[model samples]
Target chain A: MTSAPVYLVDDDEAVRSAFSLLLGTYGISIETFGDPAAFLARAPKLKPGVLVLDLRMPAITGLQLHERLAAIGCDWPTIICTGHGDVHACRRAFKAGVVDFLTKPIDEQVLVEALQQACAALDMRAERAEAAHLVAQLTEREREVLDMVGRGWSTREIAESLHLSPRTVDTHRANIAQKLGTTSVAEFARLALIGKAP
Target chain B: MIAAPSFEPASPRMPRRLAFLRSSAALAGGWLLLVAAFGLYAAETHRRALEQEVSESGRALQRAISQRVAQHDAHLTSLSALGLAQAQPSADFDLVARSILRFYPRIVAIDLVRLGPGGGVVSSARAAGGTTADPAAVSAAVKNLAAGRAVYGADARPGHYRLMKRMNDTMAVSLDIDGRGLVEEDELPGWARLDLSSAEGPLLEIGARQAVPPFAARTVEFAAPIASETQPLRLSLHRTVTLSQLVPPLPLALFAALSLAALVLVRSLLAHRREAALARAAAEAASRREALRQHETKLAHALRVNSMGEMASGIAHELTQPLTALLSQSQAGRRIAATGGLAGSPVDEVLAANVLQAKRAADILVRLRAYVGKSAGEAGMHDLRTSVSDIAALSRIDLGRRGIALDLDLPEAPVAARVDPVEIEQVIHNLIRNAADAVEETGRGDGRVVVTLTRAAEGAVITVGDNGAGIPPDILPRLFEPFFSGKPEGMGLGLSLCESIVERFDGGISAENGPSGGALFTVRLPAAGAIDEAKEAVQ
Candidate 1:
């Protein structure tokens, strides 16, 4: 499982140095770039990540970079940092892909909180990807009978579609749940995203 | 800026044109009268002299002819008797001719033509000199004589005295006559003097024949047949008269006329020269005035700039504070942004509000451009109170910084007057600054200046009140004089030139000790054009 890479970009050296230092306290290893171009050059590594960006810079604003990142399928979580105005550019960064925006003269606590959310999002995506991999493994007959039971099919409908007896179909569903390591057929059906994800 | 010259005359400044026009009219009238009168007087004298000349010449000629004939008759009568008595005609003929020659001083010739047995005898002529005359003049006289009338004519040659005369219808006889060139210039009453008179321009003039006429005081000529009806003989006399002799007043008239003409011309020339000198002087004075005005303007401008320079540090502080706040707010926002989108966050509101604050910070910069723009004379009607308030606003912080107290007693209504707002503001500000400096010098907490405005009979009155030590007694009278400053830092012309401009507007300004123990400057403008005074109907 892979956690997303978070991009942090800023213009001012002191602000960038100190801001990244505060973000480091949240235990999130941010891929820092001093400018948008440095950030954009690495954007192709779209293994889902959070982007922490500065709204204002000499070349290629944070909003524009958000657009560039979004174009490259790099949308994960984006955060905008600004030293002066919480301007249209900052709002625009959020709309482009940024999850949140912050102004400079920052409180160290806020930076830690924002970075923690972004890292947690990355952890959730990794867990979800491992779970999806585990769900990909199943026997074909067990999967068909499990599909019929997961659809809330009655024992008579399963006998008509599969040309099997209703009692036999029910036994196969029970085996399916056991193989899937859920004690109840209901839990199996819920784990299988059965009955329209109810 | 072209305007009609104001009809209101300045008290001490006289108009040049009225003076010049008066002088020119007087000069031109005098010149025309003098020339005309002079020419008329000259012509009148010439006419009278010519008339007198003609009359006297006729009488003198008649007298001389009668006298010469009488003398000739006596001699000829005796000689005729002697010749008739003698046997040989040639024997005593020399005596007869000699007798005739005895009066040669007057006589020119003796001649005889006798009639004998053949219808006429041989005619013979004798003379002291040649006896030829102009055939035409002589023939005309002879023709008149043939009709039995005595005839005579004036001399035909110039610078010489001669005459032609004829008598007709008489028997042949011996006669005596004067020839054309027989009268010598030395024999005449005045021959040499005549030439001198000619040199002084012509006295007698004849338009026809273009001949130089002989001078004549008196002339006489006579013609008659000599004891006969067929033969002719004539006698003549002439005396010349000078111009001085004819009219004694000639010199006086000419002298008076020429002197008058000379006087007119000289006076006009002198007047023109004097006017030119005056014009040059006026131009020089105007040029000097313009130069002084420009210099004062420059001084006022520099003072304003220096006053603004004192505000430079404050302006920077005013600008920098907002920018710093904006930058700090932005940095804090960036730090806060590290967190995820707030759930019903108060931070979003702070971010939006900070953006509005940043724009306010930039507005201070826009207002600074006004002070940096060009300052020029733009005089118009302005509210004095408003201008004063503006100036006070400029100095408010400085006064506070210096711990100076300012007192304002402005009128409730608009106190309007014509002025250059910028320039007037500069003047008031400079005055206030000076007052502040004065108060600062004394280092007293009680220092105060009162600015007061009131409408009086003269017009609007403005006073800048100060409680510092008053001007020295010696400097009071010349306080507004140029280059005379009471302060050590003063270059002086400020008050002096200000007074000039005020006076130009027909206003008066003065300084005196206030009743409150301070120096007060009071400026009074004429109520004529001031709206401040126009509001008097209310009160």
Candidate 2:
């Protein structure tokens, strides 16, 4: 898999640059913005990546930016950094779906680990999207066969439940495999769950 | 800010002395007048008693003399009757005449004379050492026989008189009287003089007259005619009332002592009242001073708490940025070194950046320590314009973060005052922060704060105002009261501390809603010269 992109936003220039350089050494490429405004203007065009944002900033806070991104249908995982972190803000950030909350003079390893976790979450989202797109291509009967198969039903049971011949259920399963590119039952179940996710 | 009440110590001595002197003079004058009145009354009473005594004594003496002279007339009439019964001179008549003379010693002599030429050979009688009547007495007797009435002849001798009576126009009887023997020596007082006189002249005098000092004695006299048919006599008594008699020493001494005691009592009462008044005044002054001292102590404590709070928040924000940078750079350097990338990588640059950040954080700590070093600083003459501008510059950092614009309008000329620079800074900082908070509360996009400094008549005038929702009328009056807060996280000592610090240097601070709908705070400081003058005035 390609390395996921990372973006860091902080109001202080030195803190921004320091975080960028530190993350770069850990093989994490980062784009830095001086303020939340600059990061927000570029948020729309950004590919799915991990967002590392300062909790406190002029014009917008990290949590507010996270909400704004979610409003625009950009569901990137976020890691929040702050000069002074409080429990309420941390709790609020988590409630807003932020991956982590960290305070300044932050432990570099902890930040890197949080960023890795965010990157993994982003990769999982991308895979889920691809799986949902592949599931959309399946014919209606094939989708029903795949659903029954994901539910651990045999081909005869599927045929009996649908009032079709077992031979017809087998053909529908073969078509689902060709469209979804996964013949394994676990892959089938994963794609089935992805297609059903809200 | 509330001005400290001034108290002048009560000066009780001068007025108290004056009051004491006034009362003392009144008491003395009153006492003297009272004593003089008593003396006059006593002296008048003594004079009246003396006059009464003299009158009574003089009347008694007149009665005694009158009775003695009437007895002589009886004796002569009896002797003439004896002569008429015998028709010639007889021993019995002589014996009777002698008895009469002996019984009444005032009659020194007795004689019986014929009215014709034979009257020269008339019978005469005398007491033990008495002498015969003189030729004048015989002539007077003969004259008395012709008139048929008895009369006393005057000036027979000193204190002596003669009385004669007619016996049927043939003969007359005569008696020589001793006037001095009529009155007893004990009948008159030692201070009195008595005199008896006939129609002719003074017949007798008794009781030696005493010499009285002029203007020092009161004289009382009693005079009356003696009640005697045969003799025309007047009796007079003279008495001199001396000073010692008129004003008795015992009562006068008692009165003087009472007056003196009253004067002392009144003077002591006045002194006691003065002392009580002085003590009360002193106590009041002491209480006032103590109250003022307690107020000052409370104000100082509040100032300390407020400054410390501001310092804590300022240190937190100021140190965080550099610390964040330093930690990041050091961790980055450590990571590069562990991977054996230090020699040729950006490790040197990272280490240098870490040092710089550490120094930046240290510099911030030093500034905060200096700020918190002195809780109470010495005041000095400082230009208000510079202080206002400096505070404005400092507040802009925090205000800008909240998107509040802070502006300064400082005069070119210096506005100077005697003030602790740190405390003044705290005042300006509190005002600016409050203004920013007010502006932010409104959440206006164009929130602005303006701090203006200008020279004023008193000294310097600093006005900090914000274009935001003005303060509520109910809260405005209590804005500077300690422990009154409008914000959730406020300790409520900011504005109160500002007032205390400003007023400490003889300056004033006030808050009001601006005309254009914002909260405005004005601080006025007395000029350095004015403060010095005030100090001199106090001294």
Candidate 3:
């Protein structure tokens, strides 16, 4: 797995400096922007990264920056950090797809944990894409058998539900397992759920 | 957080109108009182002067009539002397009688008679062209004469009289007189009547008898003995008169009336002048108050700026980003330093960031100072709770030093209002300072000031309560009166300025003692958004 840098966009230079220093000790590469416009100017070249955002700032707020980033196809996992957060700010943060809403002065452990979760989510996205690619190779009949198996149905129950012979259902499930490269029903269910997700 | 309080200016029209009515009524009432008093005095003086004049005139008339009657008696006495010398009816005796009658016309008749044994008049001598005495009256007179005494008699006609005198031991004389000849009827004033009589009966009147009017009349009576020894006949005169005829003439009465009228006019003019002066004074006072109010507003704005300048560092807390960043950076630097520190760029970068945040905070202060320095800017709608909290932050340190704890109770809903933010803050700051001072003065066990903001139909209500010495009863009514102070060092402008500010915003302020023994001040202001809502409804 490739390491990705954590991007920090905040008007407060000291907050960016302190968080960068702290995360550096945790072995994370960090990049800082004093303004959202400056970050947006370089957004096209950004790789997948966890973004630590300040809710309140002059020119453009963190939530507004998030929307601008998303408009430019740069939807990074965002963590919001601010001195205060009212109901309106909290509602706006969630609406902007913030990974975590953190109020400053931020706790070191919590920041670490939230970053770890975001990294885990990125890893999961990579795995889901890989799984989706593998599942795309299955035939229609094989895919039906995989869906039933993902529902925890027996091969015979899958045959009855699809009005097919049990032996034929068994053959379709084997072929799905071959194409998906996962004989485990749990793995199959995850791939099927990912495919089913909107 | 210091809550924003409502500030509505008071309208002076109602109080001024009431004051005008009261003063006008008082002025008019005083004018009427003076008129009544003067009228009574004038009337009393007129009555006294008229009474005196009438009384004097009546006495003078009576005296004149009496003197003339006495003169007739003197003539009668000379005739009696002549009768005593002559013995019988002779030409000489008749000559004496005629001569007396010619000299005194009031003596209508004179006669000499000799008494018989039965006291009858046996012989007599008479004067012509004179009133005749009755023979019966002469007989009666003789009877009395025979007893060695003179007698007087009066007939039914007014001013008619008879007198009998003993000339000697065997002789007597009779005289008949008309009293009317003593006085001319025209001599009396129009209002007066005079009567002359003897003890015997009614004699005569100079004028027709007059009926007394309902009001008072002046009367004089006089009596004089007609003859000395021969006859004890009395001459009496009475005079009755009314004051109108006898009052001092028309010019004098008119002068008195005119003087009274002039006095009333002068009094009314003076009253009008005094009322106008009072009204002018009231107007000047109101004008002065308005000027003072403008001055207070300017001073309040200046004071808010001064306070903000003084609390520069504290206000910097409002820029949380810089402070939070500085605090976190410094903490991170210390943490890094504890681990033997970082190499060149990392350590240098943290220090640079700290400097940058400090500079940013300074910039924030500059911006805030500029904001606070403005005076009489256009009013803007502001959140009530937030404004109040900002004021509370400014006063927190001062209260802390005095060991007074300020607790704010703000409603969840936003109380929006329109006002100059700095001016409103100054009003709140002053109120909080007053609360702190009161708490310090009381020196109670615990010092606490609770500030509460509530929304009402009329507007927003802000109440500040202190657990300290309550407002003194005598000073409570004048709590917001300019220049009225209970404290030795107090300028007493704080609450007054607050009231002026609040009233300017179409609000009201009041002070009272809380039920639990503390001072309470309430400020009410019209809600800003409510007006827009009403306008929208109307539209």
Candidate 4:
């Protein structure tokens, strides 16, 4: 699975360095910036990554930056790190689609845990795209049979519904299962429930 | 009570002491004058009375002695005349002379010398201790008698103050009183009246044998002619007396009376004046004592006070901040664990911050507990933001009261100072209140209190300026002295006390007419926390 690069934004030198080092220990890549202005300057080229932003900064604080990122339609997953936390800032961070709100001087273990969860969420999103690619490779007739099978239709019922032979419907379902990497029609039905292409 | 001097000076007793000395001198002078007058009168009367008594006795005694001598002369003449008239002159001259001599022992010699023809001696007779004079002396005496004159002489031969009177009588007889019994006088009165000597000089010639003190006598000599037929032109018989004597008793009585009267006058007048003078002096002394008591009472009263010194309530309110902050610092630190800031922060760093805040609070407490740390906790090398914010916090009520707007001009640099911060806030509060009051007094509330804390190389200066009535020309001089209030309800001690606290911490506080046409109080405190070093040695 591909990992999302974390954009680490903090003002305290020691805190930023320590957090970056812990993320590095977990083999997670981090891009650190001192202030909101610095982060916003490079924001356009920023790829999909988890944002680790210090909540308090002198000019254009963490929440404001989070809002700006939202306004810019930047859809990166954000995890907020703050020296001090208030209910308002936490609520605002969450409303800005921040995945986690953590306070510093951060615990190495908690930080690593939060960052790993954030990365896994991003990896799941990438895995769904790969599953869609495989689903696109199946013939249109095979997709029809897979859908009916996920609906708990018998092969004979799918043949009668689409006006095809029962033998032909069974062969389409087998091809859909092979393409989606499911062992049986039941597993294929579960993959389709997750909106996975089969 | 005597009235005191109108314009009193340091020592009210000065006048009383002078009065005492003046009256004392007058008393002494009057006493001396009275004494002198009385004594002079006494002395004059005493001398005059003594002189009168002495002179009268001397003259009377002289007359009495003269008469006694005359009687002796008459007796001798009677004996001689009985033998003379219509009968042959048969009276023996020797018998007459001897008889006369026996009756008078005071007479040392009696010579019966007959006048010679044509005033020369006819016969000469002498007593036992006497010799007949030489023929020349007898002849001289006969010539003097023929010329009808007496010869009164001092003793020519040793022994008497003698006078010879050669009288024109029937016979020339010589009488001499010797001075052998009259020497070494026992009394001054005898010296005054008599000179009985066998010598003659200024003193011896003064008297003849008339009277004498017992130890001394004087002599007079005389010669006259007798009534014998052979002695026709010579004078012979005479006697002389000495009048050296003691004081006569009668006039001394009158002299004593005169002296007594004069002495009484002297003593009485002197005593009266002395008493009067002493009374005057004592009265002056008593008055002086009273005056001194009054002056001492006045001085003693100046050194005491009756009531407590009053200060403005506004200043008292301002003074409580650092004290409150010092108290709140620890109390605020206790609320820390509840906030959970410690979770990510080092425990030691948090603890140290708490300690530092406590130290700050403690420093203020100790500094203030000295006289009064009557400053707000807003000043010093404060984070400029905190300093500005604190003044705003403290002056809120004052701003509301005046209906005035307050603009705080703060610099970003940390304006550390050695100052009474609370006092500076109070000064600001007062200025703002004054601005509001000034506007309200005139029915205008557009007043503004501008508090400015500016930094220069010299120090940090805080000015609280207002657009109210500027300080009057007369009120400016003592604006900083306690109890010099301007408002009717004002205790007037606020600015003065503020200036005191500010100056105590080596900061300067002053008031003036602002360039913006209002009263301005400017305080300049040394920045760099310069006076904090001074605090290490304090407390």
- Please write out the lDDT profile of model 4 over residues B1-539, one tens digit for every residue: 11122212222223342243235465455555555555555545654554455555444444444444454455435533432331333447556656766765444555444455454334344455655554446545556455233343344555532223344454544555444322223322442434322112432333343454454322222322222222121211112222212223244445445554554565565556556776666677667556645543532332121101114222332333333333233323333433555533566356447546645643443443333323223343444345445546445444666576777777766677644344444455455566556655655558677778788777778777777777786777557655677789976666655654565555667778888678887877766555555444332
Clashing pairs in 2: none
User: What digit string (tens of lDDT, one per residue) describes model 2 on residues A46-122?
Assistant: 87788888875644668888999889877799999865434445666776788888766676767778887888889
Which docking class does model 2 fall in? incorrect
Worst 10 residues of 4 chain B by lDDT: B301-310
* Rank list by DockQ: 2, 3, 1, 4
Per-candidate interface DockQ score: 0.02, 0.20, 0.09, 0.01
Task: Give the per-residue lDDT digits (tens) of candidate 1, residues B44-94.
Answer: 676566555544543454354345544554555554455454423454666
TM-score versus the correct structure, for each prediction: 0.26, 0.42, 0.39, 0.28
Enumerate clash totals for all models, in the order shown. Answer: 27, 0, 22, 40
Chain A only: give the TM-score of model 4. Answer: 0.77
Give the per-residue lDDT digits (tens) of candidate 3, residues B307-364: 4443442343245555666655564565566567453567766765765665565455
Candidate 2: regions farther than 4 A off? A1-198, B1-42, B73-87, B116-118, B134-148, B211-218, B244-280, B298-539
Q: Candidate 4 at B497: error in angstroms?
A: 32
If you score just chain A, what TM-score does every candidate get? 0.65, 0.89, 0.83, 0.77
The residue-by-residue lDDT of candidate 2 on B1-539, one tens digit each, is: 21123355565554443364456576677778889999999988888888888888878877887786677667767776787776577888888888877777777788776666445536788775566765445665466345456777765568877777766666667777788778766766777788888778888788777777775676789999877778888888888777988999898999899878976876676678768878888788788667545644544554566557444534454466768777787777777776885654576666757756665665565455445434446888888776676556556767988999888887767778898776787798889889998999988899999888888787888999999899898787567655568888987768766865786677778888899999999999888898777665444
Each model's lDDT? 0.53, 0.76, 0.67, 0.54
